[model samples]
Target: MDVELKSLTGNGTWSVVSLPKDKKPVGCKWVYKIKRNPDGTVERFKARLVAKGFTQQEGVDFIDTFSPVAKLVTVKLLLALAATQKWSLTQMDVTNAFLHGDLEEEIYMSLPPGYTDTSSGSLPPRPVSSNDTAAEEALKILLRSHFKIKDLGPLKFFLGLEIARSSQGISVSQRKYCLELISDTGLIGSKPVTVPLDPNVSSHKETGPTLVDLTPYRALVGPHMKAAQRVVRYLKSNPGQGLFYSVNSDMQLKAFGDADWAQCPETRRSVSGFCVFLGSSLISWKAKKQHTVSRSSTEAEYRALANTTCCAPDKGGEKDCGADFSKGHDRFKSSERCLLLDGDDVAYTEWF
Candidate 1:
C-alpha cells in the first residue's frame, strides 16, 4: 500500500483540494491482489487505489467513457503475422496505466481510507503524445520521457493466456487459468470428461424447471450449472491444449461460416458463427445470437456471412492485418480472399 501511494503521489495523479459547493465527491478504496506465476508460486503483491466510479452520476460526473484496449482477435492476428515473419515479441508494462489518460470533467474524489489528509483531491489533466519509432533507443527514450515504463523482456503470460514462441510457431493457452478456474469450483479431483456438455440434453429458457436455490447455480453458471462444470472437467483433460500459429503458413485467408435458424426457443433468433484462417492459423472467430429474427435459413446464412466479412481483416489496415480484403462491398478487392455464398436462391449483392 505504501509503494502504491508513493507511486500515485510521485506521478502527480491528484492534488489536495477543498470540496466545492453543490458537488458530490466519489470515494476511493485500496484493492490488494497476489499475482502468481504459472507454477502457482507467488510472483509479487500488488495494491491499487480504485475510485468508486459507480457512485457518480452519468451525465454530470462524466459524459462518455472510453478505455483503449486491444481486442483478443487483434492479439491473435498479430501473433500469427509475427510468427510468419519470424519477428521477436517483447512484453512491456506501464508503471501506472491510469496516469496516461486525462479526465475531461472536473471531478473530485475523497481521500483513500488510511490516508490522514482531510481534504479531497482533484485529478489534473495529463498530456499524451504519439510518435513513430525509427529505432529501439528512440522508442525507449520517447516512452520514458512521458511515463514510467517497465520492460518485461519477452511475452509469456498475459490476460490469463500463456504465450510461447518456438521454431515451429507460437502457441497460446490458458493452462494456468484453466486449473485455477477448476480449483475455484472444487473440481480439481473430479474425473475428466471427453465432451464439454451432453448433446442430448437440450436446454431452453422456458423448458427447464425453475431453480429453487439460485445462489450456488449463479455462482457456478448462469443457468446450466451442471453443464458448465462438465466444461471445466473437459478442460482438465487437456489444460495445455491451445492454438498454434505455424511459421510455415502460406499467408492465405480462408473463411467458413454457418448458422442455426430459429435455434433460440424463446426469442426465435438465429445463432450464427464464423471462423477465419490466415494460412492454417485461426485468427478470428465469433459465435453470437442475431439481433433480429430471420425468417428463412438463407437469410440467417447471409447474415452470418455478412458478419464474417466485417470482422475479417481488411486491406486498409494491411500493415498489421495480413489479409487484403475490402470491408464494405460484398466482393473482396483481393482475388485470393472472398466471402462466397453458393445457392440458387442467394443473389450476390453489395451490402455492408
Candidate 2:
C-alpha cells in the first residue's frame, strides 16, 4: 500500500484542492490481488487504487467512455503470425499505467483511504523491429524515461492464455486458468468427462425445480451449475488441449460457415457457426444466434456466410477460402478472388 501511495504521489497523479460547491467527488478504494505463476506459485502481490466511476453521471461526468483494447481475434492473429513466422515475442507491464494518462474532464474524487489530502481519481505498445537487440533496448529506455514499467522478459502467460514456443511452433492454452476454475467449483476430485455437456441431460431431461436463491451459483457458474461442472470435468480430461500454430503452416486464410435454421425453440432463430483458419492454425471461431429470423435454410446459410466474410479480412499475398454451399445467393458472386470448393469441384468464387 505504501509503495502504491508513493508511486501515485511521486507521479503527481492528483493535486490537493478545495472541493467545488456543485461537485460531489467520487469515492476511491484500494484493490489487492495475488499474482500467481503458471505453476500456482506466488509471483507477487499487486495493489491498485481506483475510483468509483459508476456513481458519476454520463455526459455530465464524461462524454466518452471509450477505452482502447486489442480485439481477441487480433491477438489470435498476431500469435498465429508470430508462430508461423518464428518471430520473437515479449511481454511487459507498465506500473501505474492508468496514472500516466491525462484527464479531460474536471471531475473530482474523494481522498484515498488513510490519506489526509483531497484528490480525485480518474480512469484512462507498438511492435519493435525483428532481430534488432540494440533498437529494442533503445525503445525500452525511451519508454522507461516517460513512465514506470517493468520488463518482464519473454511472454509466457498473459490474459489467462499460456503461451509456449518450440521448434515446431507455438502452443497456447489456459491450463492454470482451467485448474483454478475447477478448484473453485469444488470439482477437483470429480471424474473427468469426455464431452463438455451431456446431450441426454440437456435435451431429454425435464426442467428441474426452480433455484430460488442463486447466490451460491452466481459467482462463476450460472443457473445451470451442473452443466458448468460438466464443462469443468471435460476440461479436466484434457486441460492442456489448445491450438498449435505450426511453423510449417502457410499464410492462407480459410473460413467455413454454416447455419441451422430455426434451431432455437423459443425464438425460432437460426444459429450461425463459423471457424476461420490462418493456414492450419485455427485463429477464430464463433457460434452465435442470428438477430433476425431466416425464412429458409438457404437464407440462414447465406447469413452465416456473410458473418464469416466480415471476419475474414483480406491480407496481402494471402489466399482466402470460403465454403461453397450453393448458388442460391448470387449477391456474393462477384469478380474477385476466392477459393471455393463445392464437392469435388474446386474453383474461384467472387470475393466480397
Candidate 3:
C-alpha cells in the first residue's frame, strides 16, 4: 500500500503532472485492531489507513466536526420500549465507518508508501513542476482512488458487548469486557468485593504535594474508564435491554436520591446521586458533585433530594412533590423493589 501510494504521487496521481510550489502534504499512519466475539472468541483482524489528523491545524484543516449522539435516557427509553413491545432487535455496523464520511474540506495528505495509480503506468522520481491549484486537484483525485475500501456489513460484536435476542427479550452483557477489565485491573486473581464501593467511608481533596510518578495512576484510570465505556457498550449492545411496557402495571415513575456529605477531601464537596425507575426497570441514574458547600449531612441529603426532584420525571401527585427523602419519610409507595442504591456506599461514586 505504501509503495502504491508513493508511486501514485510520483506519477501525478497525487501531485500534478508537474511539481507544485509551497504546499505541504500531511502525514498518515496505519492503525490496527483485533475484532472479537462476545463469547470471548477471536473474530478477525482489521486495519485502517488514517491521515495524521493531529498534524492538521484546527481552523484550517477542519472545523465544525461535532456530531450529535442519542442521550442515555433516550437509549434506556428505547430499550424499555423494545422490551415492552417485544420488537425484533437487529444490530448493523458500517465497516470503515469513519471512511464513509465525505471530507468537506480541501485536505492534502502525504502519499502513503506502496500505493500507486495503475493508469499512470510507471514514473521516475521526478519533481512535479506545476502550480499549487493543479497539484491540489491531482492529489484530491488520487485520494478518491487508489485506496481500496469495503464495508463489513452488520455488527456481531462491538466494544465487548455481546448481544443476543429471544422471544422473552434482548439480552445485553459484557462478560468478555468484564473479564478484560478484571484482567487489566489485576482483579481476576483477587477476591471479588460484594459491592464496588464502601458505604462507610468518604473522600476529600488534600492540599498535599502531588505525586511524582503519575504513570501508574494514569494506567489505573485508563482501565477504569474502559470498564465504564464497556457498561455503555452493553446498553448499546442490545436494543432489547430497554423498557418493557405492559398494560397490567400502573404507569408510575419513582425516583430515589441520596448523597455523601464532604465526599471529596480536597474540595470538601458532597457527592449527590439519584436513579429513576419505570415499572421495574432502571431508566436513568446520575452521580455528580454538589454545586455549593453543604453545612451538614442533613443539608447535603436535602440538596441531593432537591436536585433529584427537579431532574426526575414528574409523576404529579402530593406524595412525590416534596424535595426530600428524610429518614422515616414515607411519601410514595411502590409495589416493586426500589433499585436505587445509596451513592455514599458505592466506591465508584467517588470518581464522579
Off by over 4 Å in 1: 116-134, 206-223, 321-352
For model 3, how does the per-residue alpha-carbon lDDT over 302-352 read when each residue is reduced to its tens digit? 777667767655423223322222222111212112213333331122212
Tens digits of per-residue lDDT for model 2 on 61-115? 8887756776667667777777766667767667666666678878788888887
Give the residue spans of candidate 3 off by over 4 A.
Answer: 1-19, 71-73, 100-102, 118-159, 201-213, 222-253, 295-352
Clashes of each: 0, 1, 34
Taken over the whole model, the C-alpha lDDT of each candidate is: 0.72, 0.70, 0.49
**Ranking of models by lDDT:** 1, 2, 3
lDDT of 2 at 57: 78
- Write one digit per residue (lDDT tens) for candidate 1, span 117-195: 3211212112111222245546667877886777666778777778898999999999998888888888999999998
- Strongest candidate by lDDT: 1
Each prediction's TM-score versus the true structure: 0.82, 0.82, 0.60
Candidate 1 residue 41 Cα shift, in angstroms, is 1.4
Model 3 TM-score on a 0 to 1 scale: 0.60
